[model samples]
Target: MKAALSSVPEKQQQDSEFLREVLEGLGGKRKTLPCKYLYDEVGSRLFEDICEVGDYYLTRTEASIFANNLRDIASEIGRDALLIEPGAGNCEKVEALLAVLESPRGYYPIDISPEILLDAERRIKANLPEMQVWSEVGDFTQPGVWDRLSMIPSRKRVVFFPGSTIGNFEPEKAEELLEMFAANLGTGDGLLIGTDLVKDSVRLERAYHDSEHVTEKFNKNLLSRINSELGADFDLSLFAHRAFYHQLRKRVEMHLVSLKKHSVSIADTRVDFSEGETIHTENSHKYSVSDFNQLLARGGFRPICHWKDSADSYAIHYAQAI
Candidate 1:
């Protein structure tokens, strides 16, 4: 079971530019790293592990929703609608959908990790041999990836974007990306989105700052990645991982805070940080029901159905393109 893997054109160049822009924007203020940089191969695997942890309720909660409500979801979309999943890491949630969905012509899994994407394709094919599987390896935020996806032979397309990945984007960018997705699918095509609902500060903090500190390692791994890929000299030990809920922003901000003043060099680029200085890494924004609905409305999506687990800690929203 072999699968072809090609480097997306100019991926390296795009990555370099992305790093430069992000680092420069931080300026002398708190240095920052983009969340996208956190998914380099190993990081993706660690994230999968994180999802399975007892403290991380987002994945399991959303999975339960799909498990319980998939029949209704499938009925709404009808049979023969194409299933497309963005950031379809490992296809665990997609497998749940496939189990309930009536016979569909094809399944499209889009992701940035070639290795994971191919593995997902192999696993899905083994389980559901009748479904034709196609894979694309590229960032979903990038243009033209959808154009290539348009080649898939299906008239009605329904996109499944689980994992609350939409929370990674700022409100504006989230809306823009949703609009892009809505435009990509034909009329009658819809989106199934998972969103983390607003919750207490303590629980939110614990979710990111786990007792075993795996999330800490996940956060600092970004520096390790920079050291390896960009030829940077980053002492991962000099920094400590910090994650907290920002009540005003309604988000969790993950940072690598310097324990003491340190200087690091990446290639010819030199950066210095003072004691207590931090590098902003990632933000997981929590949304209220009203705020989330407004976002969907702005993105031209009409909320059709929403499913919540017992605690109502998270929500799985099924929306249609308007």
Candidate 2:
């Protein structure tokens, strides 16, 4: 059965917000772009390609952790528990987890894109014939999602947040997001989070700046999206992809550098770029297990236990809401 997608009524606001953010970010002294805008339908497809790129180890590494520790992870989650993945948990990942869950109550996978969420719903239901699934599509942080979650009845609700996506949030926002997850959870509810650990800068840099250049395309797609949607005139050939690891900040930053001086007009707005000027796009933050535990504490969660891969390049942690 196809699960009904709980749509957030934001279709009207999405485009206007995108344009506004693009204008605002571009006008700033240090030119930057919203990272979320990089996941349009086109960009989303490119991201799927990114996951398959050989240098992008985060996906494969986390998969190995789950594959190796599925039983133990399931035991921690307990029986008849409702599993909620806040964002981006695909059908295959959810099905794999559900396979080992002890009489799982249901699964709620929320994402902003209807295209992906609906497809995920079909695939998940196809695989788990009897599983209860509620897929929501929209900004998961909004009140609509909060209500949707609190309304569901279950013995335990565990937010299965994987993929080290939380690493993308700034520390303050990370704590706020965790607190939001904590607020949605009742007593005994859990946050199963995965994070990319701090590692050698060389490996970290290569992960984002892959040899296959898929990451480059992933980064450049933002410009293509802006050009297509906002009526912006950007020559994709004039921009080059740049990514590097910042060891002190423990993050990898992605940017698009202008190869020559230019001005791209977007719906009557002229944004100027100098030769070698860059538009900061995204950052993937890494964390040590202890540092993340401290973050969880601030975010109203108590770390229970964590699972790590053989080399400790990544970690999956289970935390209880305080």
Candidate 3:
């Protein structure tokens, strides 16, 4: 496989240090966990399995929208544009774009997973031989992560952020992220973003808490990561996976709830939790079309087009940097 530029060990060290600080601070109160820790190689594989589960309709729905609208999306963006995908996990949705977009000048997949990003780049190059493939390994939220991206030699840049990854951030943080993306582009540059729509509670809850138990494994894998990385003795079996739709918040919160009163030691650190105490793992906030438009406006973008499935359960919006 082609190797993308590796993320420096210093960056990995900084990430670990940040995790330590967040854990220490949260340990003092109710324990909390950052969602980023959920994606080690194994965790990433489990998440992909979760996406395929029957109850997990988000991925299939989004893929369907991409498949149906690929030509229109490509035509709208014009030819020979630089297709840059942020948080591009596995590049599954991107393949749809590549299949339809005519002769893209370059394909840049920006992601934190160096291994996955490299493998994805290799696959894209093999399939789309005419397209130059570049990969960036860094946290998408960092300020200067895309500075090198600006140096890529393409006149038209089209940012593709699929799979409703934006839902991972709070509204304000999402707006900030969009603004950062807008700043990365010139006036006529385009953004194609996928967003999960506000849907019924039953369907939303099932999507997170899948019947196959894959999502559960994915959620609990974070503790396993802590055990491996920080020399922690975490009884992963003692934590039950919990995911539910919060009606008021309009989001699905994933948690790892203690099955019984338990004490765990991580290196020199020890923490105790009563039965049923949970570590807040992740929140995926759903949105409406108007809500999404407001977010885009806040980020200095003007919506050019929006497409949705027949049920209107999800949307793919194309916006232009204003």
Alpha-carbon shift of residue 153 in model 1 (angstroms): 2.8
Model 2: per-residue lDDT, tens digit, 129-160? 88888787766666576577667788999988
After superposing all C-alphas onto the true structure, candidate 3 shows an RMSD in angstroms of 1.9
Q: Alpha-carbon error at 38 in model 1, in Å? A: 0.5
The local distance difference test score of each candidate is 0.83, 0.86, 0.84
Check candidate 1 and list the clashing pairs: none
Report the poorest 10 consecutive residues by lDDT, candidate 3.
1-10
- Report the C-alpha lDDT of model 1 over 1-322, residue by residue, as the tens digit: 2235555766677668766864584465657777987887889888998887888888888888878888888888778878888888888788867867788867788777889987888888889888787777777777756766666677678988999999988889999999999888776678988999999998988889888888988998888887877787889989999999999989999998999997988668778889999998999999987789999999989988788998989998888898
Clashing pairs for predicted structure model 3, backbone only: none
lDDT of 1 at 142: 74
Give the clash count for each candidate.
0, 0, 0
Clashing pairs in 2: none
In lDDT terms, which candidate is top?
Answer: 2
Which is the leading candidate under TM-score?
2
Task: Put the candidates in lDDT order, highest first.
Answer: 2, 3, 1
User: What's the CA error at residue 276 for candidate 2, in Å?
Assistant: 1.1
Model 1, TM vs. native: 0.95
Range of the 10 consecutive residues with the lowest summed lDDT in candidate 2: 1-10
